[model samples]
Target: MLKFFYEEIDFKVPQSLKTSKWLKNISLSEGYKLGDLNYIFCSDDYLLEINKQYLEHDYYTDIITFDNSEEEGKLEGDIYVSIDRVKDNAINIGVSFDIELRRVLVHGLLHLIGFEDSDDDLKQQMRAKEDECLLLY
Candidate 1:
Protein backbone atom coordinates (compact mmCIF):
# COMPACT_ATOMS: atom_id res chain seq x y z
CA MET A 1 0.00 0.00 0.00
CA LEU A 2 1.13 3.51 -0.76
CA LYS A 3 0.28 6.31 1.65
CA PHE A 4 0.86 10.04 1.77
CA PHE A 5 1.26 12.23 4.80
CA TYR A 6 2.30 15.78 5.61
CA GLU A 7 4.39 17.43 8.33
CA GLU A 8 4.91 21.13 8.89
CA ILE A 9 3.07 21.67 5.66
CA ASP A 10 -0.37 21.43 4.08
CA PHE A 11 -0.18 20.02 0.58
CA LYS A 12 -2.38 17.50 -1.12
CA VAL A 13 -1.09 15.12 -3.74
CA PRO A 14 -3.23 15.35 -6.88
CA GLN A 15 -4.56 12.21 -8.46
CA SER A 16 -3.39 10.02 -5.62
CA LEU A 17 -5.33 6.93 -6.64
CA LYS A 18 -3.90 6.95 -10.14
CA THR A 19 -0.47 7.65 -8.77
CA SER A 20 -0.65 4.69 -6.44
CA LYS A 21 -1.59 2.33 -9.24
CA TRP A 22 1.21 3.70 -11.36
CA LEU A 23 3.68 3.17 -8.53
CA LYS A 24 2.45 -0.34 -7.93
CA ASN A 25 2.98 -1.14 -11.59
CA ILE A 26 6.43 0.35 -11.47
CA SER A 27 7.33 -1.83 -8.51
CA LEU A 28 6.03 -4.89 -10.28
CA SER A 29 7.93 -4.01 -13.43
CA GLU A 30 11.11 -3.84 -11.41
CA GLY A 31 10.51 -7.36 -10.10
CA TYR A 32 9.32 -6.28 -6.70
CA LYS A 33 6.00 -5.90 -4.94
CA LEU A 34 4.97 -2.65 -3.38
CA GLY A 35 4.51 -2.92 0.35
CA ASP A 36 3.74 -0.26 2.91
CA LEU A 37 5.37 2.72 1.26
CA ASN A 38 4.84 6.04 2.94
CA TYR A 39 5.53 9.41 1.38
CA ILE A 40 5.92 12.14 3.96
CA PHE A 41 5.89 15.65 2.61
CA CYS A 42 7.41 18.33 4.77
CA SER A 43 9.20 21.61 4.83
CA ASP A 44 12.94 21.89 4.22
CA ASP A 45 13.61 22.58 7.87
CA TYR A 46 11.71 19.50 8.91
CA LEU A 47 13.66 17.37 6.45
CA LEU A 48 16.93 18.97 7.45
CA GLU A 49 16.32 17.98 11.05
CA ILE A 50 15.58 14.45 9.95
CA ASN A 51 18.81 14.45 7.99
CA LYS A 52 20.86 15.72 10.86
CA GLN A 53 19.28 13.48 13.45
CA TYR A 54 18.91 10.27 11.50
CA LEU A 55 21.45 10.47 8.73
CA GLU A 56 24.03 12.59 10.54
CA HIS A 57 24.04 14.92 7.57
CA ASP A 58 23.30 18.58 8.15
CA TYR A 59 22.09 19.38 4.65
CA TYR A 60 18.84 19.76 2.82
CA THR A 61 17.94 17.31 0.07
CA ASP A 62 14.94 16.81 -2.14
CA ILE A 63 14.15 13.40 -0.74
CA ILE A 64 15.42 11.03 1.93
CA THR A 65 14.37 7.40 1.78
CA PHE A 66 14.49 4.88 4.59
CA ASP A 67 14.33 1.35 3.28
CA ASN A 68 12.44 -1.08 5.49
CA SER A 69 12.24 -4.06 3.21
CA GLU A 70 12.84 -7.38 4.95
CA GLU A 71 13.67 -9.48 1.91
CA GLU A 72 14.14 -9.49 -1.80
CA GLY A 73 11.21 -8.76 -4.14
CA LYS A 74 9.42 -6.68 -1.54
CA LEU A 75 9.61 -2.89 -1.48
CA GLU A 76 8.75 -1.23 1.81
CA GLY A 77 10.00 2.06 3.12
CA ASP A 78 9.44 5.61 4.26
CA ILE A 79 10.13 8.31 1.71
CA TYR A 80 10.54 11.74 3.21
CA VAL A 81 10.25 14.53 0.64
CA SER A 82 11.09 18.16 1.16
CA ILE A 83 8.39 20.14 -0.60
CA ASP A 84 10.45 23.28 -0.30
CA ARG A 85 13.33 21.68 -2.13
CA VAL A 86 11.10 20.20 -4.76
CA LYS A 87 9.61 23.58 -5.59
CA ASP A 88 13.03 25.20 -5.70
CA ASN A 89 14.45 22.41 -7.81
CA ALA A 90 11.54 22.58 -10.19
CA ILE A 91 12.15 26.21 -10.89
CA ASN A 92 15.93 25.74 -11.03
CA ILE A 93 15.64 22.80 -13.41
CA GLY A 94 12.98 24.47 -15.60
CA VAL A 95 10.40 21.74 -15.13
CA SER A 96 6.80 21.87 -14.04
CA PHE A 97 6.23 21.40 -10.33
CA ASP A 98 4.06 18.37 -10.89
CA ILE A 99 6.65 16.69 -13.08
CA GLU A 100 9.48 17.34 -10.67
CA LEU A 101 7.42 16.24 -7.72
CA ARG A 102 6.50 12.96 -9.37
CA ARG A 103 10.12 12.39 -10.29
CA VAL A 104 11.22 12.79 -6.69
CA LEU A 105 8.40 10.57 -5.52
CA VAL A 106 9.41 7.77 -7.87
CA HIS A 107 13.07 8.36 -7.17
CA GLY A 108 12.49 7.23 -3.62
CA LEU A 109 10.69 4.13 -4.79
CA LEU A 110 13.55 3.37 -7.15
CA HIS A 111 15.91 3.39 -4.19
CA LEU A 112 13.75 0.91 -2.34
CA ILE A 113 13.79 -1.31 -5.43
CA GLY A 114 17.58 -1.75 -5.21
CA PHE A 115 18.63 1.25 -7.29
CA GLU A 116 21.36 3.58 -6.10
CA ASP A 117 22.80 6.88 -7.32
CA SER A 118 26.06 7.03 -5.39
CA ASP A 119 28.18 7.50 -8.53
CA ASP A 120 27.86 9.36 -11.79
CA ASP A 121 27.15 6.27 -13.85
CA LEU A 122 24.71 4.95 -11.27
CA LYS A 123 23.11 8.34 -11.06
CA GLN A 124 22.65 8.44 -14.80
CA GLN A 125 21.04 5.03 -14.71
CA MET A 126 18.83 6.09 -11.89
CA ARG A 127 17.79 9.19 -13.75
CA ALA A 128 16.96 7.15 -16.78
CA LYS A 129 14.83 4.86 -14.71
CA GLU A 130 13.14 7.85 -13.17
CA ASP A 131 12.41 9.29 -16.58
CA GLU A 132 11.03 6.00 -17.73
CA CYS A 133 8.80 5.84 -14.72
CA LEU A 134 7.72 9.41 -15.19
CA LEU A 135 6.30 8.51 -18.55
CA LEU A 136 3.57 6.72 -16.68
CA TYR A 137 2.68 9.79 -14.70
Candidate 2:
Protein backbone atom coordinates (compact mmCIF):
# COMPACT_ATOMS: atom_id res chain seq x y z
CA MET A 1 0.00 0.00 0.00
CA LEU A 2 1.19 3.54 -0.82
CA LYS A 3 -0.08 6.44 1.21
CA PHE A 4 1.05 9.97 0.47
CA PHE A 5 1.86 12.44 3.21
CA TYR A 6 2.12 15.98 1.95
CA GLU A 7 4.58 18.23 3.71
CA GLU A 8 2.82 21.37 2.65
CA ILE A 9 -0.84 21.02 1.72
CA ASP A 10 -3.37 18.31 0.92
CA PHE A 11 -2.40 18.02 -2.68
CA LYS A 12 -3.39 14.90 -4.56
CA VAL A 13 -1.10 12.89 -6.75
CA PRO A 14 -2.50 11.89 -10.10
CA GLN A 15 -4.44 8.63 -10.09
CA SER A 16 -1.93 7.31 -12.57
CA LEU A 17 0.79 7.37 -9.89
CA LYS A 18 -1.09 5.22 -7.45
CA THR A 19 0.22 2.07 -5.84
CA SER A 20 1.27 -0.67 -8.23
CA LYS A 21 2.88 -4.06 -8.52
CA TRP A 22 5.88 -2.32 -10.06
CA LEU A 23 6.64 -0.75 -6.71
CA LYS A 24 6.43 -4.16 -5.12
CA ASN A 25 8.81 -5.44 -7.77
CA ILE A 26 11.30 -2.75 -6.80
CA SER A 27 11.12 -3.88 -3.19
CA LEU A 28 11.70 -7.47 -4.21
CA SER A 29 14.61 -6.64 -6.50
CA GLU A 30 16.48 -5.66 -3.35
CA GLY A 31 15.58 -8.88 -1.54
CA TYR A 32 12.86 -7.22 0.43
CA LYS A 33 9.09 -7.09 0.52
CA LEU A 34 7.05 -3.98 1.13
CA GLY A 35 4.36 -4.16 3.74
CA ASP A 36 3.68 -0.50 3.18
CA LEU A 37 5.31 2.29 1.26
CA ASN A 38 4.65 5.96 1.73
CA TYR A 39 5.39 8.75 -0.70
CA ILE A 40 5.47 12.46 -0.03
CA PHE A 41 5.12 14.92 -2.88
CA CYS A 42 6.00 18.52 -2.31
CA SER A 43 7.19 21.64 -4.06
CA ASP A 44 10.81 22.52 -4.73
CA ASP A 45 10.85 24.94 -1.84
CA TYR A 46 9.43 22.42 0.57
CA LEU A 47 11.82 19.65 -0.39
CA LEU A 48 14.77 22.06 -0.36
CA GLU A 49 13.93 22.87 3.22
CA ILE A 50 13.92 19.17 4.10
CA ASN A 51 17.22 18.67 2.33
CA LYS A 52 18.75 21.52 4.30
CA GLN A 53 17.16 20.70 7.65
CA TYR A 54 17.56 16.92 7.65
CA LEU A 55 20.58 16.33 5.44
CA GLU A 56 22.49 19.57 6.24
CA HIS A 57 22.85 20.45 2.53
CA ASP A 58 21.76 23.66 0.89
CA TYR A 59 21.06 22.75 -2.68
CA TYR A 60 18.09 21.51 -4.65
CA THR A 61 17.90 17.76 -5.25
CA ASP A 62 15.51 15.66 -7.26
CA ILE A 63 14.42 13.30 -4.51
CA ILE A 64 15.12 12.18 -0.92
CA THR A 65 14.23 8.82 0.65
CA PHE A 66 13.60 8.20 4.34
CA ASP A 67 14.05 4.60 5.42
CA ASN A 68 11.54 3.61 8.05
CA SER A 69 11.89 -0.13 7.85
CA GLU A 70 12.04 -1.59 11.34
CA GLU A 71 11.29 -4.83 13.10
CA GLU A 72 7.86 -4.74 11.49
CA GLY A 73 9.61 -5.25 8.16
CA LYS A 74 7.59 -2.83 6.11
CA LEU A 75 9.27 -0.84 3.37
CA GLU A 76 8.45 2.33 5.19
CA GLY A 77 9.83 5.75 4.28
CA ASP A 78 8.93 9.17 3.00
CA ILE A 79 9.84 9.78 -0.62
CA TYR A 80 10.13 13.51 -0.91
CA VAL A 81 9.95 14.69 -4.50
CA SER A 82 9.74 18.05 -6.19
CA ILE A 83 7.27 18.19 -9.06
CA ASP A 84 8.86 21.39 -10.31
CA ARG A 85 12.15 19.61 -10.78
CA VAL A 86 10.45 16.67 -12.44
CA LYS A 87 8.93 18.99 -15.02
CA ASP A 88 12.27 20.48 -15.91
CA ASN A 89 14.01 17.12 -15.95
CA ALA A 90 11.37 15.64 -18.24
CA ILE A 91 11.81 18.59 -20.59
CA ASN A 92 15.59 18.28 -20.53
CA ILE A 93 15.63 14.50 -20.91
CA GLY A 94 13.12 14.67 -23.77
CA VAL A 95 10.91 12.04 -22.13
CA SER A 96 7.24 12.14 -21.41
CA PHE A 97 6.08 13.39 -18.02
CA ASP A 98 4.94 9.92 -16.89
CA ILE A 99 8.24 8.35 -17.83
CA GLU A 100 10.31 10.93 -16.01
CA LEU A 101 8.08 10.70 -13.01
CA ARG A 102 8.50 6.94 -12.90
CA ARG A 103 12.25 7.33 -13.07
CA VAL A 104 12.34 9.54 -10.02
CA LEU A 105 9.92 7.30 -8.21
CA VAL A 106 12.05 4.26 -8.85
CA HIS A 107 15.19 6.15 -7.95
CA GLY A 108 13.93 6.67 -4.44
CA LEU A 109 12.82 3.06 -4.15
CA LEU A 110 16.21 1.88 -5.31
CA HIS A 111 17.82 3.78 -2.47
CA LEU A 112 15.84 1.71 0.00
CA ILE A 113 17.11 -1.45 -1.69
CA GLY A 114 20.69 -0.71 -0.54
CA PHE A 115 21.59 1.13 -3.73
CA GLU A 116 23.96 3.95 -2.78
CA ASP A 117 25.10 6.95 -4.87
CA SER A 118 27.16 9.08 -2.50
CA ASP A 119 30.04 9.41 -4.97
CA ASP A 120 30.84 9.26 -8.65
CA ASP A 121 31.89 5.62 -8.59
CA LEU A 122 28.71 4.45 -6.94
CA LYS A 123 26.48 6.71 -9.00
CA GLN A 124 27.12 4.58 -12.05
CA GLN A 125 26.21 1.44 -10.16
CA MET A 126 23.08 3.08 -8.90
CA ARG A 127 22.10 4.11 -12.38
CA ALA A 128 22.65 0.57 -13.56
CA LYS A 129 20.36 -0.77 -10.89
CA GLU A 130 17.83 1.86 -11.80
CA ASP A 131 17.97 0.87 -15.43
CA GLU A 132 17.74 -2.75 -14.48
CA CYS A 133 14.57 -2.07 -12.56
CA LEU A 134 13.24 0.08 -15.36
CA LEU A 135 12.91 -3.04 -17.48
CA LEU A 136 9.82 -3.96 -15.46
CA TYR A 137 7.84 -1.08 -16.81
TM-score winner: 1
C-alpha lDDT of all candidate models, in order: 0.94, 0.79
Error of 1 at 119 (Å): 1.0
Model 2 per-residue lDDT tens digits across residues 1-137: 66667766455655545446677876876677775678788888898999999999999887999988784445777789888888889999898877777888889888877779989989999888777777787
Q: Which pairs in model 2 have colliding backbones?
A: none
At residue 95, give the lDDT of candidate 1. 100
Q: How close is each model in CA RMSD to the real structure?
A: 0.8, 2.4
lDDT of model 2, residue 130: 74
lDDT of 1 by residue, 54-126 (tens): 9999899999999999977889999999999999999999999999999999999999988999999999999
Best by lDDT: 1
Off by over 4 Å in 1: none
How much is the lDDT of residue 89 in candidate 2?
95
TM-scores, in order shown? 0.97, 0.85
Off by over 4 Å in 2: 7-19, 72-74
